[model samples]
Target: MSIVIGDIAKECITVDPSTKCQNVYSMFEEKTALEGIVVVSEEKPIGLVMKTHFFQKLSTKYGFDLFMNRHIDLVMGDELLIVDYSIPITEVSSLAMNRKQENLYDLVIVTKQNHMYGAVSIRELIMKLSELQIRIARYSNPLSGLPGNNVIAETLQEVITYKRFSVFYIDIDSFKFFNDTFGFREGDEIIKETAVIISDTIQTTDNEPSFIGHIGGDDFIAVIPHYHYEELCKEIIFRFDRYIMRFYTEEEIERGYVQGINRQGILDNVPLVSISIAVVHNKQYPITSIEQLSREAAKIKKRCKNITKSTFLALTE
Candidate 1:
């Protein structure tokens, strides 16, 4: 997808470590616009050679006589940045920013399963990241800055065809009462905190990047591989319970409840804000469409509402 770093990569020549430096120089001469070349062994990238750096080395005193006849690996940059083809531009950009000062402008070697695929210039990486930010700004939720309803719907549709995944419908319990009593400002802080909790927990628990979306106020959604749904749920709850205590006063925390109006229009003592995650997965059942996905998650969410404190309910039977 256009969201990945490889989508913006430029094709570059690959030379084995044993290739002569002069041959690499000739390849650069043939492609005037070429910025770099990847040095590979058995198709796996071992180093990168920037055209400017190569020329600088060759132009040095005795540089031509010394390196022109030697193997390219002798002059190749072993400290280059490399990333998987499917890595997100955001992640790769961070990796690029942290490079040594001298290697800051080097092209990033893009690979698939450790095989050199292409190179991404600094200019191309910047441009693609700018485009991604603009797109997110247009489609993201204003409050949490997570993907909004439209993006969530699209993600759901995309994952509907997957053979195995768990779609989590995350709801904040008693959020309306908390907001009404504490004011919009406090409510906003809670929303942002919740977003961070979900995002961080999922990131730590999963090896691959999980798709998380904000479905507007007090609700979020995440689509991840079917495995470890229960473990993931427990982690989310544990983090939320520990962190949520900070938002309330010591007295209220001690009391374990807040006075607020109920949905039935009567005054009542509403419990402190808690989280509920209703997970619907297709590991055992066939989830044919978005409609089926929503129906199953909705049923689980209803069950989750009846539970107290932070908890998770998964569709198992």
Candidate 2:
């Protein structure tokens, strides 16, 4: 049994159409997932207002004071895209995507008849689709969706618990030049493809369970049980280097391309996509904490980035 729209939807946040905008903003702040509030009157859904509308109104000539003076009805979206509890998750996802395309809201209110029932987020919809055996094209970078720093912390924690592992921090050398030359989207695709390759390489071996995490942008981390550290890093570097070459134009690959210097005075070039990797085997140092292990791995990663002109690998003693 697949998860359905009704199974995943959160209870809807509702407000009277006459509610003051100030109150709405306060409530919205309290409910982080409250993308939009459904306006109801006399037990019937009437309109919808979103936080973006509130922010836009805030930036007007009146600014924050407008919240005190205006009613939600004044800012509500009149034409709403809503789903019923009975709607199939697939149909709900389509409706949600259409709403996102037409408007920037992240959620849609689900209702029964005219009364509000619940709301669904795009994240929830995607998860539901995955559960239903549907494969949607994921736009997020395969290595690190947002490439936020939290992934690094999580990887370290995993190592702390497991005790005997190797941590490899990987970076692409001269990625900025490629981005500058081929356009950012192409650079993004290359990064995504690189992430996929790195992930696949690390997980392929039959050694202890390994983890691959994106540290955002061009940085990635792979955790392998101590037994497989050597083989995994070698495989990752080999596969990543091979795959990266395919992303460049033949001329650019052959002749290479130079990039303008930034304020940092580093000569930028569209060189062959190479990776600098720092590997640390936990059994040797036996890190007692996640933070210390992460700091050490990051330090080594930075060192690899600094000394190597192209691709380099360093292992912690």
Candidate 3:
């Protein structure tokens, strides 16, 4: 099996060319894996900037004063190697290995047409090449490239065994209808966006370590400690609802949405891409069996699914 660029690409961090250097510096500090940042305009990639550029600017005389006033466009590298998403990993690897410092561009910017997709790091590419040779079961969803069901289960087991945490099962409501109406490509984009939103929300607001997993299709699971679970859920729901609602057409938005009826004939008029969440806390209570606990939590999720009244639910018992 050949390696692919998508296999090792890190998620892209984007900034506007007009954005202040201070903001870019702050983002880099927050995201350590950010090897490079893409400068985008109207969702299109225009230039690339690296961590070293910031350091170089900082080392100069009166660097702090300069950085405080400079914009990203003035220092960003305008000539970037743009690659299509389907490029082979071997090709990307060769490109990274053969390039010298004089021709050094460690990050490859990937996109489809004009839209900004993501970025890939040469170091990460090299590491992935090593990992690929080993017998590793990559827990990736072929469609979204997010971790799949097996990973979710393993993460749940680990969280339950070691730490006191709350696990949340997040489902996108009316996803099927959205797929049916807008076509699969758009549906895929929505899924990717939802994943990004969930990831960003967790990373920004929660200080506690979080274990997040993609459980196929429109379902996601997050395991966070009890203290932060409530706040995390609220933030997720708020962001998700705000973003998903934007994906709908103005006509559909105004027409009052209709969802498929359950076993009973009922008219549900919720937005096509709302989120439904179910949370279970791991307490000190005696558990006769793990399977039983899982079943109870699943039952709570089912009950939450039955009512059309709420988008989030937490299992108290």
Candidate 4:
């Protein structure tokens, strides 16, 4: 589940609307770090009063003499933000950042089902947002700018929850040979270009909400609708095969292979890279968990790779 405001909201002090300014000031003096207090009526937050604003009013020339005895409602800030406790922290951060400049430091009141829940500080909200962004970045493949292995597992879990979707585990064949001969820079470019090809092909198709994740290097995973899974796979392989040669030399392109040192230290010719897609759809197989889906896809991927061509193999029955 997504992180919500209630996860970080702090318990706040509340006072009645009829509470005098002098009484509110006393509360502030007791809690030196308290920035604001919620003004509630019948256990529902109605307004907010920032300690600085209240003290400023009291410190004015002859101001204390006039409003010290007056009710806090006389100087309380009415323009306040009240958010549902279940709202996403990221969303709340956006709302807080967009507040009026002068009132930006004000506390945000949180409510649950129309009842006062608590309050959130803008500073805490920002910190949570920053942490979320860092986590996303950490799980993203730097080369392809696509979500990496960690996100792939999470996405698979979510797709499995729906109990109706196809997972395509994609891999590039003979990729290591190309990387060995072409060098790391060229290898990185191929990975980046492959990501673009997959993303672009998916966009051209009318499959909405398609998920494409890179599992680092030359491997990727995609969550697509079951209806058009085969057609989409064909498109990806065709586009990749057509465009992959652009990164190859004229001789390698004409000869259809590149020469590289094999793992056994023997110099030999290696075929150009090809894509292998292993498709597993819950419609045909009952996927109870991400582990089952991954294990099945890996099994199918090995079979697809042995075919010596860019192709996709799907689970049948």
Candidate 5:
């Protein structure tokens, strides 16, 4: 089973917003393991107080007299980072990275719906992410080092839960022919080159970060926001077409095709390699499962291959 933030979330030591600072300090003193505590009101987490900052304030001369009796909320730090308990650890890592550098070590609050569920420290978040990375690396493709089928299924399930995303199924056209005509080493280069093309296209875009995974061989998958999927696909197909021929020999470039054995072992002239991308989104249809998405994408990809050029087809209907 995939891991989520809730799996590692620690039970938060909490204080009522109306509690005095001295009482909160006592809770910290008694529970030495408590690095921080959430300041909650009406069952909602409103603020956070870290032990280091809390003690720093009390260490100042006359600080105890000034703040000892004040409400905990008055001394609590600004609102804490709140995340849903069900969110995957990978997504949480991204959120953690975007936090202010000064507060980089701050604890993140985990919640179920609007109420506080628990809390997780930056240290724990980093450790979980590191472990996840190691596990994924073991299953990643040997060449591109991208996540493999297991990670792809996990990512797809996570993305579809949002109920609004575009799944781009990417495949190479005439890839078998290219492999048969060229040597296996050259075919490997084409696969790697395709990986670079898709990767660079998505990385350079200003849109929200998307998940890209290798589904093995010439097939890849990208889960992106609906708004950015079309533009991303356009960029990938265009860049691939413009630079793909660079890998071919001068003769092959001039001939614009390769001589290879067809699947039936008959001699045939196959066109140069091109890309076919099929996009399926929940904008118009309710895509319920990974199997359904894959089947639809395969159907659309077949249509794209019929075009005889590098192109993408969106399944809007």
Candidate 6:
């Protein structure tokens, strides 16, 4: 899923600094399609000479006579954009665009361990960047594959403005426990699994008007019917308990916890990961603002975490 500049660089004709400008001109004349020449010294790129810019300078008054016999270094454009072969193309694209306008179309020199590798044309860079983005969107999610916090806020507003909707705030209980004990990669899988359960459960809740979003890592929000929330919450908890257990081992489950360091840097037995859902609505209490809904959900979420298993608590009062 990772693509670097080297992956897209094409072979570029190279010259040494001491090479004559006349020699460079002949090379360009001989190769009609040659776009640029890289100047190298001690196996490292030091400058670049673009065909368009080179001819532009040569076409100036007395330009050819004043420079043709001189060393190519004297006439070659030193304003350069050089990037490491290992740098991601996404980052390199920004560097390429930010260069001085005169150097905008210059071939970007690619180096490996600081030695010359090849050159990437602006055309190749743009085409590869677009293609990589398409692949990433289709496969990588950019990796989370969920609508983000801004969408979550809009969902909240819609709930308050238009209709009576139950808010479900799903938090992974002691997610840090698994994240610390197992590492982020393993923890990420847990988050993805939890997302699936929430999405599937909400979608099946009598096909009521609903929306779900990831409020970033390990926290999710859903809006569903006020009437159907009880069934949906129980189903989410049931499915979570059944499916999430696969991420743990028999020994850890038997022991009922994993060892992890807490925020105070104290080592302790952190309980197994569980789901906590705080269900809130305007039915029992006046939902005046987003902040109030959050305040109520936070209180219910705290109480839900106190229980020993996957559980849900509704806002009361």
lDDT of 3 by residue, 1-317 (tens): 23456555556788888899888888888988667788999988888888877667777999877876788898788767777665656566666667667436558877766577788877676677777534224777666655677766665655666446677787877677778667899889878887887777764323344656688889887666554567777888788767766666778666657455533455555555677778777574633444755776788778767754336777673
Model 2 scores a C-alpha lDDT of: 0.67
- Candidate 6's residue-wise lDDT over 1-317, tens digit each? 13678989877899999999999999999999899999999998888899998898889999999889899888778878888876768778989999989899999999889889999999999999998667544433233666676556665766786356788999988887678777899888888888888888886426445666787778888887565688888989898888878877899898878777877899887788888899898786578788988999989988997886788888862
Q: List the residue pairs that clash in candidate 1.
A: none
Model 2 TM-score, 2 decimals: 0.49
Candidate 4 per-residue lDDT over residues 87-154, each given as its tens digit: 76766777888999988989988999999999988887888888977887888898898888887878
- Candidate 2 per-residue lDDT, tens place, 244-317, comes to 76765677666655455644766655346677877766555567786676678677767776653444454543
Q: For each candidate, give its TM-score against the true structure.
A: 0.88, 0.49, 0.51, 0.57, 0.80, 0.53
Off by over 4 Å in 2: 1-152, 247-259, 262-271, 307-312
Q: lDDT (0-100) at residue 197 of candidate 3?
A: 74
Cα displacement (angstroms), candidate 6, residue 4, comes to 43
lDDT of 3: 0.70
RMSD of each: 2.6, 16.2, 15.9, 6.9, 3.7, 17.4
* Candidate 2 weakest ten by summed lDDT: 134-143
- Candidate 4's displacement at residue 317, Å, is 15
lDDT of 1: 0.85
**Where in model 6 is the C-alpha error above 4 Å?**
1-141
After the best TM-score superposition of candidate 6, give how far the Cα of residue 126 lies from its true spot, in angstroms.
Answer: 28
Report the C-alpha lDDT of model 5 over 236-260, residue by residue, as the tens digit. Answer: 9888877787777889878878777
Instruction: Give the number of the best model, judged by TM-score.
Output: 1
Using lDDT as the measure, name the better of candidate 2 and candidate 4: 4
* RMSD to native, candidate 4: 6.9
Task: Report the C-alpha displacement of residue 157, candidate 2, in angstroms.
Answer: 1.7
